[model samples]
Target: MSVLSAKFGHRICGLKDGRLRDIKTSSSNVRNMEELEAERAAQKIEYAAQVKMEQRIHNKLKIVKQQFNSILQSWHHSMHQLRGKVPGFV
Candidate 1:
């Protein structure tokens, strides 16, 4: 006998046996697909938020680096002026 025959025997000849099982399986499959879609949507939202946060942090660091470079240039200019004032300084 086939697998279907073993499971349902003469019941397979009726409309309720195999049909009902197929319906139940299809319904559960739909529910599982919906749940998986919802989870994927949530993950996408989280990933977008994370990318935005990383961009903000990168911009902040760029500003900090610019400020540090400005300060370093100013310090170097002051040192050059002091060297000029000091006698025998090359």
Candidate 2:
């Protein structure tokens, strides 16, 4: 027979026990669904936080690169001045 038919018959034959067990299983199923939904929401929040952190890191890297380029340009200018002072510097 089908599972439902068996459960129904069991409910009739074992009255109190079968009914209580079925109710407990149903309640647990609801709890499991709620817990799964909560976990999904938490995961989404964590993913958003990680994305924000990556954006911050990217901005910081861009700033650092700009600073390095500026420093290099300054050094080049100073070297050109020193070379100009030397006699016969190519």
Clashes of each: 0, 0
Error of 1 at 55 (Å): 0.8
For 1-90, candidate 2 gives per-residue lDDT tens digits of 112332312321234435422222355665676799899999999999999999999999999999999999999998899889987765
* Model 2, position 20: C-alpha lDDT score: 26
TM-score of each: 0.64, 0.65
Off by more than 4 A, model 1: 1-25, 88-90
Worst 10 residues of 1 by lDDT: 1-10
Q: How high is the CA lDDT of each candidate model?
A: 0.70, 0.70
lDDT of 1: 0.70
RMSD of each: 10.0, 9.5
Clashes of 2: 0
Question: Local error of candidate 2 at 71, Å?
Answer: 0.6
